[model samples]
Target: MSLPDMRFRAEQHLRRQLDFQHVRTHGRRHDCGAFMLWYARQAAPIAPVAAVPAASTDAVSPDGATPAETAPRSRSHQKKSASGPIPARVGVVASKSAVGNAVQRARAKRRLREAFRQHQLRVPAGYDLLLVARSSLNRLEYREIERRFADACLKIFPAAKA
Candidate 1:
């Protein structure tokens, strides 16, 4: 059965939530390995920060701005999933080199992808993500991987509380 929906946007205020496996849960694939965090909101992309001169004039009065203009706009589909900004990614470290074989790698990647698909909602709409396989992964059973992966997902994407 589906556990529940938890996403990054669902929890952005807490500081401690930005670490690896700070949260826990389970997935269908191998136990979760760990999670890496990222953010899509760029303070400065192509524009140089230094060039951002101080406002030449007093800011527009709040009364002048329209209500609709103040509302948060819906994100485009590209920024919704893989296309969107990836705030978090995960990596599965194999425990031993013996587990690094091609067959093992495929198994691990499959497990990772499977886990991701099962809980894609944990991730926010905008965020870049990459899952790496580690050597420590070989020793753990798939269930363990699932648990770890779930934890990582929660860390990246927290669930909405009722």
Candidate 2:
């Protein structure tokens, strides 16, 4: 089968340390054969903007609108209210203590990432997902890893299936 055109952009990943901590603290957990999935429903954080100075009354437009009034709303807010379901984001953790050597940890993380990349569409939106790898994960075949990951996703999001 041909691979889908979808790309795993940085926006789709859990990049912030706080985001991972939030999921670990508030999310529910699901365990598969070689991995544990932690997920929580939380609003995506808004990017911080430098505070703009208040416009003076004299700066008002001829149409009686301030610059702020004419400015467009944030796209993130719009995305939160869009009609369709949002895409699930993921964070993969394969620590040295959990997976031994650096090479093994890298391999384990890569496997987890590939599985998530393939099946991320099957996952529902508005969730922060974290995949913690077990030592056994390195020994598993790619297909087995994929199966376990998919099963974990299904268990967490039973209603996401079409």
Per-candidate Cα RMSD to the true structure, in Å, reads 12.9, 6.7
Error of 1 at 3 (Å): 12
Q: Which lDDT values do the candidates have, in the order given?
A: 0.45, 0.80
Q: Which ten residues in a row have the lowest lDDT in candidate 1?
A: 39-48
Q: Who wins the TM-score comparison?
A: 2
lDDT of 1 by residue, 1-162 (tens): 976644424222212222223222212232233422222321111322232322534444368754444445543321323444433333333333535677877776667656655656665543333455665665677777666756766764576121
- What TM-score goes with each of the models? 0.41, 0.74
The backbone clash count of each candidate, in order, is: 36, 0
- The whole-model C-alpha lDDT of candidate 2 against the native structure comes to 0.80
Q: 54-94 in candidate 2: lDDT tens per residue?
A: 56745776798886776555544324445555567789999
lDDT of 2 at 57: 43
